[model samples]
Target: MKLAELAKELHITTDSFIKFIQDFDLELSECISTDFEVKEDFARFARENISFLKNYQKDLEQPKTVEDIAGNISQPADKVAEVIRKEKPAIYENGVYRSSVSSFGVDQKLGGDYNFVYNYFGKRMPLAKRDFIGYRDLFFYISKALDPFANENTTLTDWGIHRPAGIILYGPPGSGKIFWAHKIAQIIGYQFKEIKKYYLGTSFVDGNETSFNDFLLETMKQEKVVLFMDDFDNVMMERTATSSVNSCDEETKEIILHHIDRFEEEELLMVASANTLTGIDREILAPGRFDVVIPVFPPNVQERAEIILYYMTKDLSDEALLKQILEKNNADHLPFWNEISARMKVFSNTMLIDFTQSLKKRIRTQYLKDNSLDIDIKKHLQPALREASAKLTDEYFEQMSRFIKDISVNNYDDFATRIENLKQELQHYRIVEKPRQAIGFTHNSDSK
Candidate 1:
């Protein structure tokens, strides 16, 4: 019989039965199949292992510790604690462990200010303020703007002592804009609320203007909120631009601009990201609407090396195997890593991450198929890396280069000053040797 049928017969959960079998280091071929044949030998084996199964079931029935729960689900303890706070609110408040069902809401609606705060910021992992990879100057500027004590030395009524209303981060897609947004919110200790296009649509109300305005008002009222809007240009494109189709109608665009004029509350910080600055409304890019507009470029050579090493070390859990791979391709230390990064100069951070994840999957599949851990990573991964590199064609680089040049020429003074300032800031910071942890939710964080 299948493991599900066996679990039914034994009056235990399939997970519990699987864990029992795994604890003994026994691999059952039919465990994952729902329609496997149950021979006499399999029945006899289960009968022989009945006592062990009973013990496991009893262990499952007992109260679980925080570590036990985390290990069982392969999640961090902080995530478990947050889920407990959500699922068993009274138990968490009482500081008591009780037998209760834990319902993880991965797709639950985020309605009001309170739900938005608890759902996003409350459950976020605690990361160091300096954990952001690059873009030191941009991060520093934004942090100062969000800081409550930024203008402590200046007079309160001074004209120069005004809080920034919002920030616009424009860059190539998959260039870590959203990641930086989340990290900014975490550093400022504010609840994050991301306003999507659907949230601004007419489905919620008879008119899209009402829906958009309501979202803005709800977000603005929160005492500590970082409102993020991804793809700013898509939502607030120039009404007169003729190149591409606009998602928002003229009335909707006018409503957005009206709200932008009124979005000067100190309690709320607005941050938006777009792939390019072209075709964006001039008014939205005006000084008061979005006080800061920064352009994020692809990673430089040093930053690329750091990113590659981070992903390579983070995904390859086997320390010995990782060391071997790093030493491969040449006698010099870390030559393999340096070589890979050099070859992947055109890769964005997101592309690097995807490539590493793909390589990890291939390695796992090979290991399982060969029934051996000994495999040549370089031999297998180099070809895959080349395939990934092929996606970054000459046309892609030309498009990106043209966009950068256009923005620079359009705002020459501001762009030149910002680029020079970034260069000076980067001189003070070196790439620290550390593995990058996966951001946001992971497989373990999802519901089973």
Candidate 2:
């Protein structure tokens, strides 16, 4: 059964259930598949412990403090505070330092025993074998958004819920916004069509000029199509009093807004890709327009490992030299890639693939020279790692910081864990600039 369905049966939000798993230190991999399938054993545990899970979720709903967490987990308040100091920032309110800090993160840091939660594990369910790696939370969220479309007997309409007319996928460059856009189309059985640059402007079509309006009218006539527009942030940016706005982009926004109301009725979904939602005009994001916002996060640590391994041995046979080297170094497994992946915090999917490509080439060269099975693979990986690490520039982090802040404000409840994890990962590169002291002024009291 799917984890979302299990959550629905338990009368709890999937976000809360995910939090429960994290708080108990339950192995997420063992309990849920990459496709968000709930292992039968974990499902049984949840059904039997429904009350316990509900009560835990109740505790999670309220803003918590160091004392609250310490009491709940039966640990010292100071220890909990220490853990929170490193993990998350505390919000002060009502005469207390409080925040929605993860009790699971705090407990793990305090060495709290959570083995009881794992007793339900009977046999490990293999990850729903997919070309994609992690981001199960994201997939589940998207599934929920498209539920009305998937279920023929869905009463979502009674609750005033309908399929979204538009979905805005926002993320940093190369985080795979376009990939998820295609995935969304695939899920709904819609034909994916890109709104090319020429389609957005007056272009010669069959020796006649056709504008964006003509393109929209013709697209709406189709049965089911997802009209994708990339670089949406650049086109739909907020127009300030003194800011220069593009006439073509303004026209594009106007055109989308004008025809957006009829999108759902016509079985057409318009999906736009943007680097960040911070700049999009508020009018364009209004309800019944393009309000369904989904974030495409860069792969987390575990995901990075999986992606690296996937690319490293992509098409190599068992007898292949690279395969032999990987097996010899035990680099074929996920754990072997963890340390390096940990260092590649906040790297995009494109960057990770580049890393694997670089590593593979270096390994091939070394093999050609040494002509040995054990060709000191680690020695070649260093340069490849350096090459990939170069892309982790200051500008990229700036973009991610904006993305994190935007998600925290708009979709915090749904993505709290990811927001927190990314914040922690970003801390490594966030250097505080100390003020420079004058060179000539040193106190000579000791010398005197």
The alpha-carbon RMSD values of the candidates against the true structure, listed in the order shown, are 22.9, 4.6
TM for every model, in the order presented, reads 0.55, 0.78
The TM-score leader among the candidates is: 2
Tens digit of lDDT per residue, candidate 1, span 15-55?
A: 55544433332223322211223434445555666674565
Off by over 4 Å in 1: 1-130, 144-149, 152-159, 205-210, 241-249, 315-335, 369-372, 393-395, 406-448
Candidate maximizing lDDT: 2
> Candidate 2: which stretches are off by over 4 Å?
1-128, 150-157, 206-208, 431-435, 439-448
